[model samples]
Target: MIVRHDAGRRPGYPAAAAVFAVGMAGTTLPTPLYGLYRQELGFSELMVTVVFAVYAVGVITVLLLAGNYSDRVGRRPVLLTGLAFSAVSAVCFLAEGGLPLLFAGRLLSGFSAGLFSGAATAAVLELAPAERKTRAGFAAAAANMGGLGCGPLLAGILAQYAPRPLSLPFLVHLALLVVACVLVLLLPETVEDPERWPRLSPQGVVVPSEARAVFVPSALAAFAGFSLLGLFTAVAPAFVSGPLGVTNLAVSGAAVFSVFLGSTAGQSLTERLGARRALPCGCFVLVAGLAMVGASLAVELLPLLVAGAVCGGLGQGLAFRAALTSVAAAAPAEHRGGTISTFFVVAYTGISLPVVGVGALTVALGLRGAGLTFTACVAVVAACTGTYLLRRPLPERNRE
Candidate 1:
């Protein structure tokens, strides 16, 4: 097992980040397959959102209850536990017979993400060489957006061209999970206390006192940005396959991947533009992307849809990384994990609630109309956030 010696040597940060990426990839593996599930199970669009929402619920629950578990136990143990959840999630998908199993699978995946969001991020940062701490930020963002982008691409390709579409995707993911687990075993543990394990108890989202000022704008930006992501992740496949008549899962997945790929690219650029500037700019760009998405839905243009995905995803990456960096930097050292957890709790809420609203809206007014409504709502939020940030600028020096 890879263990870190506290003798001023850096642990294997790249390997740890890779493990984080693989684990995250498993979380979104079902993005393109939702259409298949709807056809096979005979469920409504609302049901799809509900199923997706369950994953967020699981993530929030874990963050609230177990977000700081790694600090007490150790990063490796919590990460391994998260991988176990990922394996179980893959199994649930592989064995899914009905909605219950689907919910279970998503819930398990959410739990895995919740555990990972805190533990893996901290591990990557801790493992970084002192000189590379700044780069560690990009590494974490890349692992996250890159992993998320790859999930849909992988599942889409398999489901489109391979036999046993649903089953094959899960099988491939399970194999990857096994590899990730092995990698986790080889990752150096960063937490100092091995015997200081605290009994797990529900600690509702721990927002830091010092971070309160930065948290508002940062979390708002994240909320708006994530709402855009939620739109694509939950319903884009249905729009492509149902309304637009694009039936290929691989194509659908590629479309989804475009947005996340853009997000990864946007994250890479955050270093050039400071966090403060990146936050509002991301919101504005996100609004532009949403406009393109709305236009695509109205005209049924595939290219427009792709553009929207890429643009919106880029905006999300910029805003999200900036928000995370600011929040983490402002948070007190002792409460860093808890504060980050709190930020994610809000971010995940953005991911879940708005998507659920869109799903519900779809029931009354078809996908196109519902999408328009979503676009309108998020645009308002993004505009408000951008305006607020501009009117009241926070200290740029807060960036670490």
Candidate 2:
């Protein structure tokens, strides 16, 4: 077995992380190009958001249904299957058949992401030697964020500079998927024949009474943070192109990248701040970012918009980590898995449901007005979450 070929455990985590990153990067590879699709297809902004929401639907569906499938089979099989789905998604994009293909590609991308979310992360942690498990955890998180951040950036640069903007991004992703499959083949099998992976089924999120105090605030903070991320991921590109008149696809992608980069940077801060401090601190920072976004929409400034993306992303990263940490710590051991799943469901809902609202709002309010409205609403939610956390901090035992 790959795990016991030598005296020391193979440093398979790096490869596993690479595989994880590649899988997630495919999910967002289309962000910068939504404008192209809009122009080519003559679709409304609401359809754009609907296309994006389709991905989240696929993700949440798989998370609820097949989250434990990887455990039942083996990590490698699930990882490979995820990669296969990613490859299919790339093919769907490459087809460029219009809305139907676009939706299919995104939905397939979501399935790949959902599979990676549980399987790839667990694989990364398990591949590491016991001594390196902590580092492995960091790798898993970074791979996820880094992959997501890189997707738009890569697609943007390629689409802007390279020939065949839509086709090239998926072409490149398909090639990467090949490398990911090879890596997965080489990695050690983390799940034994008789493993007990978390059994996450169609059951709704279960927040036991004992965990409610921490769960309420933390989940709210996550909801708000994820909502900010959703806004950017779904519509920031259009906002950049429509109001700001920035035609460069690279610029749009960069704007989206900044937010995720900020989020990744913020998550690192949680390590130092601990759960008690980070949750409230992240909320306030997120509020600041949301206000900046509102101001940017009002004034129509590209730089301000970018800055807001990064700041809000940072706050999201911070609160997300702290919230997950606190919620997990608060839950009774037997019920922890279900509670965590519930937390993610809330978070993903924030990512999907609000973006659709913004899409619908765009019909009545102009893009700028709709964005302003969104920023105000999300900002208030974030601010309230922060204030609540400050007034009633998590227990000291819940500290990082």
Candidate 3:
């Protein structure tokens, strides 16, 4: 086996993970406050999802075009640039006047996330101690989910109790980004060569022929899983306030947080049950959760909605982590990054496109009808995916 010389000696792993968490947190900070934007701006539900989709567009563009930039120019530089984008994104929100500003903020946030997904993850892994690889993986995953969970939580608390719901969260995020930048500067450079910057071009989805069999199922599972996340992040609050009659911003934020928190908890379960078991198991739970959500929409019950969020979030976490593990192990080392990028591209598509469909359906179907329709469709897809995985489980040798 190949060994890394500085594996156990590096001190930047924790710092990099912290920075990663902060940046990811910034991307979702506006989630709970979308309703306020709607109230002030007089925009439609379709516009909400359209704005969210724009962020995904920015992320996919960056992943395709500059995903490997850190591999050449060095992690610190790329991360700093990402942080800069984060700062600009915050400024966009802070200066928001109309739809254009909101769109700008979200797009910049997407750019920041695309950069973090590659450079920060690589930096965290590189800085980790060799024997602590498993722990590092957990750290990175937790930082991602935990940070995402914290965003709406923080924004909700601030929006409900603090002044300027639209303004405070971004301001707080800007401060955190500044701190993250300083920490990044202090971390030792992980990349060995800084002079070998290659001519950059879009490296769109690169799937090696050998990995196709497992990749299809993995990508499908990811797509289904991320759609659950998309639903909660994009419009769960609207569901909460509009149909369920819950008007507290903190409660709305908490609802969103619960899904992500459940996801984080589900990810930990992967270690116990293994990815093979976790992948299908997650889909089943997700389907059940969707069922609950559909019922809640029909009956207008907040408790059922909350219950669904927890259960579905857990399922998503479990399946998402398993999918990542399975795909990573199956991929050729040289092509791993691109393969994973493709997986995320599918996942992000799930997050964007389906939610936008929900937005479109809302015009004719109304919120309850739109919600019921959304849940039914996603549940069916998840059920089908789960059944397929159960029927053709990954080979025993490949599972961890």
Candidate 4:
């Protein structure tokens, strides 16, 4: 949310956002094809989440280590580096030696995403003309979530309807990455006189005393909300194919995409609701979505599962945006960027760790049982936070 201004900046946020979207799309390209991998490579359910979790680990590691790298150097170099990682990730999927290649590919993909997350957003925001700043912000958000949502859908359609299920999805993505790299080449550098190769400085987590009250609940809400995303990308396809009786890969991909679409819709409401109110409101909606997910698992109903994806995604997006805004406002301006970086560490942790737990549960409880348990626990966390927030909402007094 903190954007630096330089004189004579170009007006190309739309192009920057397009670059962001293309880069992110590669991150989730493997979602719908997990089942095919399991059938061909013979890995367990737990392995699926582990593969997904590796990407999160990569992202978190990069965020902690070089999260401010673009600020020190420049956005273009970081973006190009991200695209390069993305291309390699696609290549790993294409080679498909075995599970090892899949994990390596996912880790590389995570590295690309980690680089893209901070740098691309800054690029989009900094590229905007003063008059279009607000719209640019929305464009950045849309590209992030919308691109993530599209990955699964695009993969599903290609894998199901087109040739070479595994190879084709990534092949198409590689082509798109080429386009993104070209776009990045065209974008003007936003950082004024940025170093070509600055020394890397890790930005450790920081939660100022004034922001703790706001940060704790906001982080918890994000943790609970992102669990659904982990569930969908890592585990939902198997659920759809097995219990829900839907074998169409496109449908499976669409199911995953639905949540992200809902997330995008949810984010659109944040400005209207105000960040302070949107956080708790999002938590309540998320809890309701979790309930539906649990019910879908219990009854084996496809419609309810789809419904849960939408509602839960909506809640996640709404709470996440508000959480970032509220915490940044509470922090001192000097520490604001570090504070936001810390927040993303927690959010990505939510998306990664709990998913592994669900995969572990699958061995003992079966997919449906594990999903039901996951939903119940997350719902309780969200509900408690929502109730607490209702009594004591995030304070706007500290907001700048």
Off by over 4 Å in 1: 1-11, 208-210, 332-335
lDDT for each residue of candidate 3 in 262-352, tens digit (9 for 90 to 100): 9888998898899889899999999988999889899999999999999998889988988888888888998988888888899899989
> Model 3 segments beyond 4 Å from truth?
1-11, 196-198
Estimate the Cα RMSD of every predicted model relative to the unseen true structure. Answer: 2.4, 2.5, 2.0, 1.8
Global lDDT of each candidate: 0.86, 0.88, 0.88, 0.90
Per-residue lDDT for 76-193 in model 1, tens only?
8999999999999999899877999999999999999999888898788888877888788678878988888789899999998999998998898888888888877877777775
lDDT of 4 at 131: 89
lDDT of 4 at 343: 90
Query: Which 10 residues in a row give candidate 3 its minimum summed lDDT?
Result: 1-10
> Model 3: which residue pairs collide?
none
- What is the clash count for each candidate, in the order shown? 0, 2, 0, 0
Q: How high is the lDDT of residue 192 in model 2?
A: 60
> Using lDDT as the measure, what is the rank order of every candidate, best first?
4, 2, 3, 1
Tens digit of lDDT per residue, candidate 2, span 1-400?
A: 1232221354388999999999999999999999999889999999999999898888888877876677677788889989999999999999989999999999998889988998898888877778887788778888998899889999999999999998999999999999888888877776666345446456456899999999989989999998888888889999999988898999988998999899888988898999899999999999999999989988889999999988999999999999999999999988887788788878888988999999999999989999999999998999998998888889998998
- Cα distance off (Å), candidate 4, residue 165: 0.4
Q: What's model 3's overall lDDT?
A: 0.88
* lDDT per residue (tens digit) for residues 77-109 in model 4: 999999999999999999999988999999999
